[model samples]
Target: MNTATTLPRGPGRNGAPRRGAAWLMLAGALLLSACTTPLDPRKDASLQQAAYTTDRPVVRPTRSVSSFSDSLMCMDHMLRAAQVPTTLITSKQVIDYSSRVPVAAKDMIITSLSQMSRLSNAFRYVDYEVDIVRQDTVQNLTTILLNNNLMQLQRPALYVSGAIAFVDQNVVTNRFDAGTSASRLDTGYSRNRSATVIGLEMHLGDFRTRTLIPGLDSANEVVIGSGSQGLDVAGRIGSYGVNFNVGRDYALGAGGAMRTLIDLATIELVGKWARVPYWQCLTLEQTHPDFQRQMRDWFDESGGVGQATLVQNSLIAQGYLQAGTDLLALDSPALRTALTQFQIDSLLVPTGVLDFSTYERAMRHFVTLAPDGSLQRVGWGPSGPTGSMAENKGDSTPVRTSGLVLTSTTPPPRRIDMQIENALPPGMEPTFEVGEQVFVSATVSRTSHMYCYFADPSGNVMRLTPNQVTPHSLVAANQALRLPDWLVPNPAFIMDASRPGTERVACFAAETDVLPRLPAPLQGAGLVNIPGYRTIEDIDKAFQQGVGTSGYVKSEVYWKTQPKKAQPAAAAPAAPQPAKR
Candidate 1:
């Protein structure tokens, strides 16, 4: 359950704070004196919020004035940028809520990570566990729900998240440097417990999601982290949905002989770190002085990380090459030489001094190769075409899917009080039937209306039964279909599209979706509403029947394709027409 070792810093937002941490020292003393039992998965448990328990049930706000707030705030901003929806816990009620529960402890870490996932609408959930090492130092766990490690892995990534550890010699067992700069460095000798956890990191998965078999998620990741000196972090995951890779390396404080134990841990994590270039792919010490710089270079050369890098490079370079000066240095006489050397193509006359243009070129390639772009299909082209052939040159992406929603060219129908009735002149009774489309501009309320009609062109009218198409979620958005042009005046009202005949499409219901729902707003020419009206006892009474369509058109209407774009140039987008309101 524990993999204690040292890992080098991967990325930094900023350092932790000072005064704000006083509470930790205060809490540390309290922790030493408190009667609370050491947290044991078997003892302390988390309260269930839904189906799972959390890590820290009770999170008492830091009592001492502190600076960690800034770190927390920065983290919040970073997560948001990642497109993760984070809900800051706003409770002022502080209570020690954690108890000894297995799920609760695990939920602490797993849950936090999972929240990251939910922010992005990614994976569904997280499951975690906790094991206590030093009892008197800290109490219960802090549950962190993790995002779907699986999903991120499928997409491939280079992630860095964790806690830090501080070791100050001047501090004795209880007198720690938790709230001061002194904590960052140690002021004493060996044999004494000189290090404490500063912050911890998270797990990263490579193409695990894309290549992993079926059932696995986080289990595929290899966790790596160390505290002030080094903290424990160990988890072996090899479930479904992933391909496995093996790697290891370690060097702490300028090659000062780090333990194999530390070496093993880093190897595990960076093996998973991945997405870094060939230079970073080498062992740590091999590129020690400038590992991170090397990594940046690799990331730049790799065309960003994920399922579509090379394809993206070719697209950005489309037609820009005179010789080797292609938009992306992806082609020509020079880059190929670098590729052969199994090294990143540096930017230089011949030395690879990659400049701003290189990065811009890489960015362009990465952007164009976005998952939904034309390059997605280039994989289907003849095996490995030459650099001269631009991939998207033969682009065949769909202009729009079968249900692609388009903006309206006209206004929509109107809402009418179908419950309202119109009074007729004496001896002039009217009946509506098939053949005449009720060219309406408004829809009526969602309910049953007394559909009354007269026999012949002048007789007593009778109310007819309604076909099933009541209260529906239609009309909420882009829902609108038209009535068949067959409805005529009849004592017995009939619905054409609702029947079975040459025109009896079928007994169906259409609420006006774009084949499927369009992901846009629906509007039209100045906006119109076609509302149906039902007669009541009097014309005035029917007028007060309310608005909205009382019935739904029953049939299947479809949209035809646009004229294919003429070749030789990108077609200009069509101007939007007002929707038929």
Candidate 2:
């Protein structure tokens, strides 16, 4: 060290100064490398924003297309009737300057189509991914994949094309600012409010002809709002300055608005194309001004023959007329009989004719919203025991009269939705083949005691649940209970369609355990009829009388049975050949 310090004072042939210089250069290199090296967690690298990150816990993503999920499901029957191939090829682009909206309008339409087709597979989507090749050469993913013998593609019959039409921002705006100053203090406040309108439009086209279908286009709009408020204070006194500011801003998410618009547009386009009563999905009653106006237009467009078709379809949907009957045969005995019965039940004049009054009444109460968010037929007159609209407007509890003769006397505040695979929606009277294994999926609006019954084509009714296999009758709210416990070795009752003809599955639910109140025939866990009740109506009467003015709801789904197709006998196993010894 003594020699190095002395030699560094001057440049000379001595190696001491050169060695010192080299050491300094090496030290600087080491420092620079340390600065550039990435931190290692093994060496205890510190975390940034870790505490704040957990302050607001992360949440799972939620579905946005739920407002009309029930309505979409209700339309499955109609869509299956059409059974057409539909495709969506909308551009993922925003037509207006509002870039904040997600480019997922096309996806929403596809989802809606899927929901409506869950049961019957109403529409098929063409997954024709596009591939832009050289100029004048464009190929779809289907063609490219098939060239390699990878997969098959389904040809599309109809295609949906459109865009996120527009987002009109700041359609309405208001702003206010106020400030006051006194002495060495100053204060101010401000607020800004604005509204926006988002719209989406889609058109249906014949994929084969490449022509847009007229009157099948849909354009829908939704409004969203945003606002902000702020306060500011500033002052100076005695050579000191002070300032304070506070702000709060709030806005509705645009994603929800866009999704709602897309759902509405999808319902409109598909409903128009399929010619179903689509307005039911939108929860619009016939009394609505807009509904009435639309009905007028449809009425004019659909003259006498069209009106008859509409009425016939309505009757079939309500279980009054058999499906596949001639719609143009308005004067048929079957039509008149069904119409007269419907009129008598609805408290209307039994005209036995398809008149405008009958049409209006039938359309008005085709479907109503159940408290459980499913769609069910009104099943009674507006002034029935369920009370008037005014009475139910403020009541949350479900009210209704029940019987085999009269299923629902008024709309209920709560309801249970029962579904069978490949079957029509409840109240549509779907059919089942004899010997078919039947499984029931019953979903309730709230946790309640549920009872399931099977009324054969004849007058016999058997209790299906609260049996030994699934003795517990309490079902959780919004939970689906599958009947005939497949998990158990011996389910209480096997729902084999041994009997043929029109049959019904009636499910009764209530806040309390109404099983004890039911007639002896329906109380226990067995396929055997209850001991006390002589008929199914007795059980219904017991419920109406015992659980009076309480939370009680019933869902009855009718299904017809036909002989199962005879299966060919398997070829007898060939006799084993005797080996030559």
TM-scores for all predictions: 0.17, 0.44
lDDT of 2 by residue, 1-581 (tens): 45544434454566777899899999999999999998777555345446567677575332343455546755764554443323333322224445658656666777777776554345656544453542132345556668999876656777887776778889999999999998899999999999998877778888778889889888887788999999999999889989999999989887767766666777788888777787865764322323434444545655777667666666665556655666557778888988877665443577787766566545544434456543333333322212243223554555332221123223224568776644345455666789887766676654568988777765677787777767788776444566665435676667867678877778888866877765554555567755556455666788888777464788876667988878999999999999999
Candidate 2, 437: how far from true, in Å?
A: 18
lDDT per residue, candidate 1, 317-426, as tens digits? 33111223333444544444433221122111222323333332232222123124322222222222233223455544332211111111222332322210112233
Candidate 2's C-alpha runs over 4 A off are 1-56, 77-100, 133-144, 235-241, 284-581
For model 2 the TM-score comes to: 0.44
